[model samples]
Target: MKKDGQDMRQEGALKAADLEDAVRRADPDRALCARFLPASVRPDVEVLLAFHTELTRALAPARSAAIAGPMAGLIRLQWWRDVLEGARTPDHELAPPLLLALERGVLCRETLLRILAAREAELDPQPEVSAWRKMMLDGAGGLQRAVGEALGVRDAGVLARLEACGAAYGAGAMLRHWPRLQQSGRYLFPGDEAGLRGEGNAFLSACDTASLPSSARLAALPAILAERDLKRGSTQAGLPRGLGDRLAVMHAGWKATRVFQRSGAAAS
Candidate 1:
C-alpha cells in the first residue's frame, strides 16, 4: 500500500532525528558546537555535519588496508556527488535531509563540492606537510563557511574569520586523532609526534578568536573546544565532556566579552 503524506512526513522526521543522534555519537564536539546555533537553523547544520561524518566513514576503509581497497571508497564518494547533482535519488538515511537542504538553498552545491574535493585530496599517497595543511584548511574551512552561510552570515570579514577558526579546529582534531591515524598507516602530519603538535599549536595561535565578531562567535565555537583539547592525548577518549566542555566554551565567551568591552571603550 502507498504511504499517505502524513506517514511520509513522520518518516522523514524520524530519519532526521536518527541522523542527529548518529552525528552526536560520531562527533560529539561538533554536536556541542551546533547547540549554539539558533534553533531554527540548528537542524540543518546538524544534518550538514552528519553528511560530513558520513564522508569520513566512507573513507575509513581506504585508510585501513585490512578492511578493503579504495574501490568502495571511490564509489561512495561518487554516490554523494551524484546525489548532490540531482542525477540520482538519495538512498541513505542522511542523504534525504541533506538533499532537502540543497533543494531549499540552505546549502550551496559549489561549497559542498569544494568540501568533497578536500576529502578526496586525503587519498594522495604520503602527502607532504604543505599538502596536508592545505587539505585541513580547505576541508574544514569550506564546511565552516557553508554553516555560516546557512546561518545567514554574508559579511566577507565574518566568513574569513570563520574559515581561519575552522582551519585551526581541524588542525587540533587531526593532532588529537594522530595515534589512530598513524596506526592506520595514515599520518595527519608528514612528520613525527612532536612535529604534529608544533604544527597544530602554531595554527591555533595564528587564529585570533578574539577578533571574531559577536555575531560569528557561535559559528566559531569549535575552535575554542579544539584549543582546549589540543595538548591532551587521545587516550582520554572523545574530547572533554559534560562540565569540562561547557566550561571551555564559557571561558571563550568571557574572553570575547572582554574584547567587546575594550573595543567599545576605545570607540568611545
Candidate 2:
C-alpha cells in the first residue's frame, strides 16, 4: 500500500508538470501574468487556462485541414464533451489534469460545456457576428468567474466586473486574431466590422475596476490589457513580442494592483 501511494504521488506530480508545460506553450501571456498570483491559487488558475488552451488548439487542425476538415474538429470537441460528462474516461494527456480540476471543483462542468459549445460553433458554415459575440461573452465570463472562485472572491460586484472584463478581452482577441481567423476560413465577425468594433469598445467602457476585490485583480488583468490593446489599435496575430508586450503586461498588472489596494483601503 505504501508503494502504491508513492507511485500515485509520482504520477500526480508528472501530470501537473505536463499541464504547466502545456499552459506555458499554449498561452504564454497568461502564464506570465499568472506569476502575480499567490502560489496556492496559481495551480488552479493554470489548470483552467490550460484547459482553455487545449480547446482552442484543437480547432487548429480543422481550420487547416481540407480533407478530414471541420468534421474532424467537431469529433474532437465531442470527445471533450464526453469526458466532461463522464460518458468516457479521459485518456488524453491534457484531459487528465482538467478532469482532476473538475473533480476538485476548481472548474465547473456547465462552464466547460459552454466553452465547448462556443468552440463547436466555429465549425458552422455561416457563423454570425451575433453568435460569435455571445460565445465570446459566455466563454470569457465563465473563465473569469472560475478564476474568481479559485481566488476566493465572492463579491457580486467584483464578479460582474470580471465578466465584463472577460467580454472585452474576447472582443480584443477577435480583433487581434482577425487575420488568422480570416485565413482559417472562419467568419467570426461576418461582414460587420464596424459593428463588431463598436460592441468591443462598449464592453471595454463598461469594465469598472474601482469595486473589484484585491484577490480578484490578477484575474482581471487580461481584460485590462485587452482594453489597452484595443485602444491602441493593436490587431496582431498574437500578443506582440518584445519589450512592448512585456511593458504592457507589467503596466496592466501595476494598474490592477493599485485599484485593488484602493478598494481595500476604502473598505477598511
Candidate 3:
C-alpha cells in the first residue's frame, strides 16, 4: 500500500516523539536541562541529544561480548559515518532527523565526525591517561558544540566556554561511572584515579557558567550537577537520585531563563 504525504508526516512525528522519550530514559540529566530551552528549538535539542545517547549505546556490544563484540560495535559506528557522509541510507528512524539537522546547519559534519572518532578510539585497547582525557573531552565537548549551534549561538567565546563546561561534566561522569566501566572491562584512565579527578576539577575551575551568554546556558547546564557529583566523589555512575539534584538543575535553569528574558528584551 502506498502512504500519502500526510501519513508520512504523521509517522515521522510519532517516531520523533518516541525517540524523545527514549532519550529521556537513557540520558536524564541532559533531558531535564533540555526542558529549559525555548519551545521553538526544544525538539531539536532533544533530538541532537538522542544522537549522543545512540553513539554511547553503539559501544554496548563491544563492552559485553568477548571476541566479535568490538568489531560489531566498530561496524555500527562506521554505518553511522556512512549515513552522515551520504554514502549509504538505511530505513533507520534517527537518520531522517539527523540528516535534517545537518542540512539545516543545526549540526556540522566535522563535529559529528569528531564524536565518531572518539567512539572509534573507545573500542581500541585502553589508552594512555592523556589520550583518554582527550577522547572524553572531544566527544563530550563536540556534543556541547552541536547543542549550542541548535540554540543559534555562533559566538566563538561562548562555544569555547561550552566545550570547557562539557569537558568538566564528562570527567565527572567518568568518575561517577568508574565502577560500572570497570565492571564492563573498560578502563578509561587506567590506575590514575586521582589524576582523572584533578582533570575534572581543573576543567570545572576554568568554567564560568555565570558569564555564559543566555543563549548557551542550557547547553552548559549539565556542569551544575557535574560539580556536585564530583564533590560527592565517584561512588556511582548514575545521575544523582534525589529531589536535591532536580532542584539544583531547576535553580540554574531558572536563573538562565531570567537572563534569557532580559537579553531578549534588550534586543527588542
Separate clash counts for every candidate: 0, 0, 0
For residues 45-113, what per-residue lDDT tens digits would candidate 1 score against the true structure? 988887787676667778766557666776788888898888988766567778888888888888788
Which residue segments of model 1 deviate by more than 4 Å? Answer: 1-14, 66-68, 233-242, 250-268
Best by TM-score: 3
Candidate 2: residue 79 Cα off by (Å):
1.2
- lDDT string, candidate 3, 170-244, tens digits: 888777877776677664766556877888888776668877778888788889977987887666565455688
TM-score of each: 0.80, 0.80, 0.89
Q: How accurate is candidate 3 locally (lDDT)?
A: 0.76
Q: What are the per-residue Cα lDDT tens digits for candidate 2 across 40-75?
A: 778778877866766676677777887978887888
- Cα error, residue 88 of model 3, in Å, equals 0.8
Error of 1 at 248 (Å): 1.2
Superposed by TM-score, candidate 1 places the C-alpha of residue 174 at a distance from the truth, in angstroms, of 2.4
User: What residue runs in model 2 are displaced by over 4 Å at the alpha carbon?
Assistant: 1-18, 125-127, 155-157, 234-239, 254-268
**Angstrom error at residue 90, model 2:** 1.9
